[model samples]
Target: MVTVKMLKPYYIKTDNEHVRIVLAYQYFSIIIQEKVYQFIPIEANEIRINRRTQKVENIDAKFAFQHGKDVVYLTMAKLITLPDFLQQLHSIAGTYYIQDENELNGNSSIQHAVLIDELERMNILRLIDKALDERDEKSFYELVKLL
Candidate 1:
């Protein structure tokens, strides 16, 4: 019998269309009989998720293990059968799915606008100071009008 002893994602990558969860050594482990096996990525190492549904779309990953001197490959079919694997994956990737890109863009735009306003105000103050230093009353009054 095989049982999962530990499962932790190495990192998560998100784009507009999908979220990819990467796994690495020491982060994922399993037990078979009395022996513990560590997952080593072979062809693929990521679990692809659909951003809209927040559901696992595919696991394009293969792992191998060293048993004695023989290399044993773990296939997708066997991995999916592990108890609570899907549930645990959902728990880790849940927060990333909840984030809305539009909301983030709105907040970023607001910050940019505030920064631009402050810069413009600073430039006006500098121009006013330059007019006063040159003893140009007309220029000083014109710069002050910007306030």
Candidate 2:
């Protein structure tokens, strides 16, 4: 059974207010003021951002985040690569943290590790299904708006 732990949040300062970001395995949850947003990691064919315009263009996904309005946008503006992501994490926590799943879990057996990987993927799919099932009309429309 896979259990999700409540991990510590990385607080970052934005122009408007301080926001808390919690990164789970393949997902990240953003806490802005009293509201929280949960997002799945979107894979893009090529993720490009114009820093001057504060516009992000992901070829695979149709999501637009303007600079100042979204705290997630502000934080993500800096993470263009793996090294950048690690640097940001280290800067926020004042320590180095790696997101290497195999190293962290210490799964030595190949077959056992594959099973674990499959289980984790299944779990994410299940959670997405649950969220879709429980979503209201407005929430559903909001997701559609992203397209």
TM-score leader = 1
Worst 10 residues of 2 by lDDT: 1-10
lDDT of 2 by residue, 75-146 (tens): 333333335443444444443222357754675576688998898777666655665898755655655554
TM-score of 1: 0.57
For residues 73-136, what per-residue lDDT tens digits would candidate 1 score against the true structure? 7765667777677678778888778557898899999999999999999999999889889999
CA lDDT for candidate 2: 0.40
- Model 1: weakest 10-residue lDDT segment is 59-68
Clashing pairs in 2: none
Q: What is the C-alpha RMSD, rounded to one decimal, of candidate 1?
A: 9.2
Q: What TM-score would each prediction reach against the true structure?
A: 0.57, 0.20
